[model samples]
Target: MTEFSSILSTSNIRGAYKSSQELTTSPVAPEPQGTGESFADVLRNAAQSTVETTRQAEAVAQQGLTGKVGAQQVVEATLELESTVKVMISMRDKVVEAYQEIIRMPI
Candidate 1:
């Protein structure tokens, strides 16, 4: 019984040591893949979308003025343009804030 207990304890210690070694030598978290569009691409897309929305709103307004479109269509386009402008403004403010924060960081 003493011999068996000694062997068991030794095996347990060996297993624990092996696990600690594995933990220390394991690879770190993987780097993010370059599979997605970049920040500049995202900003460019957003700007394009905003411009398109504004153009659509203007077209709808012109159509309404010419008696070709209904008031509902114009109102919807205007609302969409308003929301897009608001979002763009908010994004700009955030980017500016981030830039300021970065600039204020100690070198």
Candidate 2:
């Protein structure tokens, strides 16, 4: 979760939506190329990471059941998975809020 927060703090969501002014303006400035990760790409990567974390946690739990993994490791994995899920949910809420705000804007 801290890692996700830090990433959010450092980068802006690009190419998510373009305003009418942005689309209609003449003499528009060229966009600067950078790391090239679109908003969808970032979301996809985060979702993949969350899935991987969940799988790992499940694996750890299974190992614990078989007495191969330590209780501490299983607990840690479960906590990490929980945090990842919470962060994803928070992000989803924020995105929905942003969409609603955009919808409320005067045309």
Candidate 3:
């Protein structure tokens, strides 16, 4: 969870959104050169990582059920999955809030 938090900080999200907004709103500004990544790519990667974590947790759970792994390991995986989901939800909420704010702006 700590690793996830470090990777997806709120400030990073805000900065990315803000930069995209600037690019769209400014006609005189030069287009950003391709750096092999866009905001969508970042989002996709995060989502993929979350899915992978969930799968790992499920595997650990199955192992626990079969007596191949300890209960503590399963519990840890479950907790990590929970935290990852919470972080994703929080990011979704923030994105939605930003969209609504943009919509509320006057033309």
Candidate 4:
């Protein structure tokens, strides 16, 4: 896991140039500096990540609850799942506020 994390760090991933035979590259496109983004985009990404994390956690829980994995693994997975949920709720609130402000704007 140490080697995996070392290779997966943002700096390490960004350091090496992509080879010609590589099928895929960076996970995200470059975010332009000092430019604002649409609230919808932010919310979309947050929701997608949350769903993915929750799915993984459920898989881990199933493994543990069925005696296929350790209890500690289940606890850690549950914690990660909770954190993702909190993030989604915060994003949802922000999106709602932005929508309300747009609605109140005068023509």
C-alpha local distance difference test of each model: 0.67, 0.63, 0.70, 0.61
> In what order do the candidates fall by lDDT, top score first?
3, 1, 2, 4
Over 4 Å off, model 1: 1-31
> How accurate locally is residue 20 in candidate 1, as Cα lDDT from 0 to 100?
32
User: Model 4: per-residue lDDT, tens digit, 24-79?
Assistant: 22236766766655545555665676677789889999999899998766766676
lDDT of 3 by residue, 1-107 (tens): 34644545476456445433432332355557864456787677778877887898899999999999987677667766776777678778878999999999999
Model 1 clash pairs are none
For candidate 2, the lDDT comes to 0.63
Better of 1 and 4 by TM-score: 1
| Candidate 2 Cα misplacement greater than 4 A, ranges | 1-31
lDDT of 1 by residue, 7-99 (tens): 334544454445334322323555377755556776777778778778988999999999999876676666656667777787788889999
Colliding pairs, model 2? none
Against the true structure, candidate 2 reaches a TM-score of: 0.67
Least accurate 10 contiguous residues by lDDT in model 2: 11-20
Clashing residue pairs in all predictions, respectively, total: 0, 0, 0, 0
Return the lDDT, model 4, position 37: 53
- Between candidates 1 and 3, which one is better according to lDDT? 3
Choose 1 or 2, whichever is better by lDDT.
Answer: 1
Which numbered prediction scores highest in TM-score against the true structure?
1
Better of 2 and 4 by TM-score: 2
